[model samples]
Target: MAVEEILERLTRGVRDMDEELAAEAAQDALANQMPALTAINDGLVRGMNEAGRLYETQEYFVPELLLCSDAMYAGLGILSPHIQRAEEESRAKVVIGVMQGDTHDIGKNLVKLMLEVDGFEVFDLGRDVTPADFVAKVKETGAELLGMSTLMSTTMDAMGVAIRMLQQEGLREQTTVMIGGGPISQAFADLIGADGYAENATGAVREARRLLASRGAAVR
Candidate 1:
């Protein structure tokens, strides 16, 4: 099959939530000597982006989105190890998590996948992460970027608390903080003294790159 055809198959597999097809297409891409990054960004990510749009329009619900993510990750599992070390080198370290009291992590997981595809070394803290846990991870990893998300308005305050804790620990200056989720906005990010905000997973990757670049950090 042509490379374009293989990539299309990969995209279709994820968009259609077919894990087997996605894995098959991913293997084909590798056999064809296609760049793993290209397969991920142009294939899997594009499929996930379409799935996201479908969810936004209410054409797909959480179950469908989760299936799509599974298919995408199936492809990613095949492609990730093939990424060139040269591309991985100098990538910024990022710490990401959902705030305490918020168990909705679909958004956070999508952002984490996008960030990984963009070559960021991400340490996922998972959902319901406490402020102290986030601070501890940041300190332990010496991560240059910190990303937090919450789907609940009530738990939004935890983002600010995390930021304040980072400041108290003297880690705020070295970390570029970014926030997003259903209840999050640029205003909230600004209000919490965050370095950046994104409205969606793709935007999260863009914002992360821009924030890191502004800090003289190398981002591929």
Candidate 2:
């Protein structure tokens, strides 16, 4: 299959949210018959961009976005190791999670999938991640960005605690922290001393890349 054909097929599946077709597209890429990295990337991520826009415009809700994200991940997973080589580069590493005392994970999960498509190697800490654990992962993985998610006002302080712990632990110099969730705000992030905050998952990815570029992998 030529890159053009591969692109058309893959994008069609993504726009339609057809997981089986997306899988087939992955198989085609794995086969590497046409060397179509850009085609594959655009199909996977452009579909996601559409889904994100739909979510922002209220044309689609969280459930729909979640499903679409799943579809995108399915395709990206098949392209995982090849995405970098085929695309000729790799993005930086990032750690993402839902904060301690917060059980919500849908937002963080979506952010994870998109960042993967964008070529970031994401280490997901999952739900109920403690400040100590967040700091430890930064040390362990040498990740440039640490993304925290919290859905409750009560648990929002946990995000701050994670940042402070990183500082007190003397590891804040190595990691940039970004927080998100319904109850979080830019103002709250500043008060909490987070390096960045986003209104949504897409903003998180954008802010994360920017932080990594300017800070040279240091935050606090």
Q: Candidate 2, residues 101-125: lDDT per residue as tens digits?
A: 8899988898888777676888998
* Pairs that clash in candidate 1: none
**What ranges in model 1 sit over 4 Å off?**
33-35, 49-64, 84-87
| Model 2 residue 25 distance off true place after TM-score fit, in angstroms | 2.2
For candidate 1, the 10 contiguous residues with the lowest summed lDDT are: 83-92
lDDT of each: 0.90, 0.78
What local lDDT does model 1 show for residue 69? 86
Model 2, global lDDT: 0.78
| Model 2 TM-score, all chains together | 0.87
TM-scores, all models, native as reference:
0.84, 0.87
What clash count does candidate 1 reach?
A: 0
Model 1 per-residue lDDT tens digits across residues 61-176: 77887899899999999999998866556778899999999899988998897787667889999999999999999999999999999999999999999999999999999999
